[model samples]
Each structure stands twice: as structure tokens, then as C-alpha cells.
Target: MCHAHFEDKYLCRNNRISNIAVPTLKMRSPLTPPSTTSLQQLNLGHGPSPSSLTATMQEAALPSTSETNVHLNLGEKTTVKKAKSRVFLTNTEKYLQDKLVAASIKLSKMKNRFKKLSVNVKAAKQIASNPAVCDILENCTSTRKLLISMQCQEDHKKEKERRFTLQEKIASLSIFKQSPKGYRFLRFFLFCLLSKH
Candidate 1:
């Protein structure tokens, strides 16, 4: 019913198919609409126009063709990409240079973080020392707090060991002395775990 809705019927009650001057239509398939040239030849006075019938049946709307999808098929159309070579640390001196540079950057960041945390912890200790909070302080020894204290101690121990390791590495690098400037890099970076007085 939906397919035939577009095509209107206009057969006279007395007229028959053999009596008409128009030739019989050739149907290629039951589903496909008749060819546009054949449909254009038809002139039913009251039916919808041939242009309207062809417009609806033209290939479904498409964004682009296969040729448009390919961008770099031609030499003139294609652009080269930025290329880089992989660098393996084969030279000991080149590897050492990169290692020293990275270690210096990491050392400065570690020192700053350690200093800030120490200041906060010192302020917290002073705050806890207030005489008015003695009753609350006496009752503050919970299992959770004990576990937290143990974790803090372990973290502090690890921090001290890491600082010693850094010092050892810097000391070991003393073998590579510069001919012009001497080992100023070692003196500049070798940090000590100084205790707060």
C-alpha cells in the first residue's frame, strides 16, 4: 500500500489497455521503480510528475566518493612526516652526562618536598604540646594512630637511606674529573641529611 501511494491511477471506466495508443511498459523487477526515460514518456494528466518519481529513487544520499577518502595517493598531494632516530646510550660519558643531569633535577625536588613536610610536622608537634589539651592528648593513643606513627617512622628511615644512596653515587662519580673545571658538580650537589637543632 505504501509503495503504490506515490503512483496515482487514472484509467477511464470504458477504456481498455489494447485500445490505448501507448505501448506496454517493460518491468525489469517488481521492486525497482521504472527507468526515468520510460517514466518521463508517461503523461497521466492528474498523476504526480515524472521528475518527482525519479528524485525519490536516485541512489541514497552519500557524504563522499571513494576517491575523496584517499588524501596522499599522489606524490604532489602527500607531505612528509617529522622523523627522529632512536639514541642508544653506547658511549659511557654520554650516558653519564644524562644521568647526572636527571639526578640533579630529582635531588632539588626531593630537598624542597622534604623541607616543607618537616616544617609542617614541627608546627604540628608544637600545637600538640599545648598544656590545655593534656586530657585529650592522654586519651589519643588509638591502634590506628599507632599504626600511622609506625608507617611515618618507616618512611623517614627510607628517606634517610635514599639520601645516603644519592651521596654515594655522587662520591663514586669523582673518578670522572674534568681537565678544565675540576669536580665542582660533586661539591654543588652532594647534600647532607642535616638534623634540626
Candidate 2:
């Protein structure tokens, strides 16, 4: 009876010690084995073999269903595989198919419209830069081709006018330096030369 009591007390102490140690063991190394050495540490490379690693990885990977079967029993005659059953569509299914097709066509048209809209936006931006082009665009509102042609003509006219003005300024500056006194003196000298001639 005394030995039995002592054994129970010893077992209780051991249980208490294990409960305390388990928490510390988990805290110290979460992945480490409770025993001193693991299988990986005991191995020469301190890791699993490549073949085993591949095998374990394959085992861990999700299993896929196999549709093809090659094996056949010798006693049983080889039977030809049955063809797939024909799919019969309900009225609702047919309606849904039609709706989906129409939706896809509408989506394609919308995409084309969006592309055209983007092109138009780019064209509008190009035209908006020049007030002459804008005025021409506003005035020539008959047809797109006519409006574009008129705007182009107006742009060319403005460009020619700008070039002519610049050339005139350059020509005047070339005849005399751009100081008021110098310009007046040059005009007076020209006037005296013209009078003597």
C-alpha cells in the first residue's frame, strides 16, 4: 500500500514536470522534434535525399483524377468505349445562348466605338490647339471631309501669313540696326544719297 502511494506521487510529479517542460520546448523551437536528433540531422547532408524530397513533394501535392484507363482483363473481351451522350438544350438554355451571343456582339461594337471615340478625341485635341482651325471648323460644319479640308486650307493660309510677316521683319532689320537713333541716321543718309542721285 505504501509503495503504491509513493508510485502515484512520483507519477503525479513526473506529469507536472512534463507539463512545464512541454511549453518551454515549444517556445525554444517550434519545429524541432521533442527527441534530441531528427531524421534530417542524423543524415549525412542534414537534409532529405533528392529522390525522397521529390517523392514526399509528390505525396504532399493534390491528387488529380485520371480519365484514361489502359488495363484490360484477359478473360473479359475488350469492349469499345461508349460515345458521349448528345447534349439537349432547354428553351431557357437556348435563350441564354442567344442572349450571350448578342451581349458579346454588343461588347465588340462598344469596343470599336470606344476606339473611334479615342481617335476623334485625338483629332479634336489637334484641331483645338489652333484658333484658326477652330474657327474654320465652326464655319465649315457641312461635312466632316469638307470641314477637315477647309481647316487644312485655313492652317496653310495662317502659316503662310506668319512666314510672310517674319520675312518682312527680318528684311527691315537687315537694312538697319534696331536702335532708334541709328535707324533715324540711316534714313537721313539714304535720303541725302537719293537727293544727290
Candidate 3:
């Protein structure tokens, strides 16, 4: 494994154990062979060293103590007791102000949405009240076009008829006014009609 991977695993392993030691080998030059002098100095039972023998014997004779375990446990516990901190520790006044601002914004958005919905409802009511407005509100392009064209044609015919009748009445009045005999006749006819009434 890579150095980072090895350390991550080692740290995780150390977190679980109360007291453990993992020995790692130090890197040495590849060209150098094992040095007998170094091994001999450490007194690895190869050559007789009286002082090293006594030191090794003394360590083996002693009992395992609770002091080492206590020290190791304390060292590992520091990371757990490092005073838990909160991410957001705002004062009461500041928190209340933030909540009020948020509520106001939410209220504004809801009011806007309600206004839009009311406007749509009002428009739908208006469309429903009048048949022509309802017909105009149809989504189909061809149907609306056809209805508008027919209405226009009917209006044009009515306008033409009204104009024709108005023109006929005007022509008859002009002719009657041009001749004195026709004017006298019209006066006699009006007098008779008024007398009957």
C-alpha cells in the first residue's frame, strides 16, 4: 500500500486499541548488506556480552504494570475530549431576526402567488359571464377565426342595409323638397295623419 493508505489504516487501528505498538522497518541502501558489527553491538545472542545479558534478564523478570496502560489510554482520549463545538452559535436576538426576515420573504412570495391566482380566477369569471368573451377565449385558432369572420360579415351586411335605407329616405326627401306640388301634397298628407291621431 501507499504511505497515505498505510497511515489511514494505522490511525484507524490505533483508535480501537487501548495499547498497541506497530514496528515499522527503516529504509536502507539496497547496495549495503547486513552489518554484523551492528547486530553484535545490540547483543542478539550471537556474541557473549555480559552487560547486555544482565539488562535483558532484568526486563524479563519485571511484571507488566498498569501505569503504561493508563498513559496510553490518556494519550488516545484527548481527541475525544476536545470540547465539541457548534457550527452555528448565533445569539437569540440575531436568530429571531433571521427568522423574521425569512418569514417576511415567504409571506411576500405567497401574497404574490395569491394575487396571480386571483387575477386568473377573475379573468375566468369574466370569460364565463359573456358568451362572446367565452368564445373568444377558445384555444383553437381556426374556430376563432371562423367565428370572427362570420360576425364581421353579418355586421357588414347590416351596415349596408342600414345605409341603403338611409340613402333611400334621403333621396325621397330631396325629391319632395325640390318640387312645390310634392311639398304641398306632403303637407296635406301630414295634416290628415295628425287629425286622425
Candidate 4:
């Protein structure tokens, strides 16, 4: 009886060891076995061999039952038509080429205009610096000064308008501050505003 019990225990231990070892043995390496079908699918430098092409043609010629029935039901028959290579350029391609040419012309014109503007600006600066040209410019300086003063007055007017707007905002805020809820709301709003800044 003791020998039978020891044999049962030994069998249980053997089963446990096998359960552990079997999984480790089954856990194969990440490197997989290469497949012949995958290798055949790969496109090497040259086109498919004559035999491969014939095999493909045979496969294509053999229609499925469903496809064959559909063709028959439609009163049509399967005919092997030679696949034609497509020539794709349309009107849009010609339009794009024309647009590209126009853009290049426009870019060249813009470059020329920029060069002309630079030359004119340089000449204007040099003329303004020369004593003879300075005398002529000085004669016109009074009119130019009037123009500058007019511009300054316009700027001042805009500044005053901006200041008035700011003052109105401040006055509105002061009026709101008198109310208890407004004061709390303003404080919360200011806190958020300051945190954002």
C-alpha cells in the first residue's frame, strides 16, 4: 500500500513537471520558417516566367460556378480581352502647366518691380541729401511740414478717441463696483484675467 501511494505521488510530480516543461518547449523562437508560396509571390527584377504566366492565365480562364451562371443568366460569355495600358493625362494637366508658366512669369515681373522700387527709393534718398536738391526740397519743406502736421493731427484724434473709450470703460467698471454682486464678479473676473496674463 505504501509503495502504491509513493507511485501515485511520483506520477503527480511527473505530471506537474511535464505541464511546466511542455509550455516552455512549445514556446518557439520568434524567427519563423520561410514559406515557398510567399517567395513565389515576391516580384524579383525580371517579369514572371512563361510557365508562371501560363499558370496565371489558366487560373483566370477557370471561372467559378457562380460567376459562370451570372454570365449565362445575363446572356453573356467570358471572352479573354487583352489588357490595354492606360494613357492618363487629361485637360487638367495642360491647365496646370499653363498656370505654372503664368506663375513663373508673375514671379519674374514681381522681382523686376521690387528691383525698380529699390532703385527709386535709393535715388530719392540721394536727391534729398544733395545740397542743390536740398535747396529745392527746402522750398517744398513748408508744404511737406503742413502735410506732416495734418498726419500728426489725425493720429492725435485717433489717440483721443482711444482714450475716451478707455475712460468710458473705467467709468462703467466703477459704477459696477458699487453693487456687492458686481464687486464679487469683478474680483473673480480680474483674478482670471490676471492669471491668463
Model 3 global lDDT (CA atoms, 0 to 1): 0.56
Q: Write the per-residue lDDT of candidate 3 for residues 1-197, one digit (tens) a residue.
A: 23432333355443542233342435344587669988776776566688877888998886567877887789778755664542455698779988999999999999999999799789868867998876665765653444344343343344334222343345445546688576557435431111111
Per-residue alpha-carbon lDDT of model 2 for 144-173, expressed as tens digits? 433244344344343334222343345335
Clashes of each: 0, 0, 0, 0
Q: Against the true structure, candidate 4 has what lDDT? A: 0.55
Ranking by lDDT: 3, 4, 2, 1
lDDT at residue 31 of model 2 (Cα atoms) = 75
Any runs in candidate 2 off by more than 4 Å, and if so which?
Answer: 1-86, 131-197
Which residue pairs in candidate 1 collide? none
- Candidates in order, TM-scores: namely 0.26, 0.28, 0.22, 0.26
**Most accurate candidate by lDDT:** 3
Candidate 4, position 178, lDDT: 75
Question: Highest TM-score among the candidates is held by which one?
Answer: 2
85-106, model 4: which lDDT tens digit per residue?
3445679997898899999999
CA displacement after TM-score superposition, residue 89 of candidate 3 (Å): 11
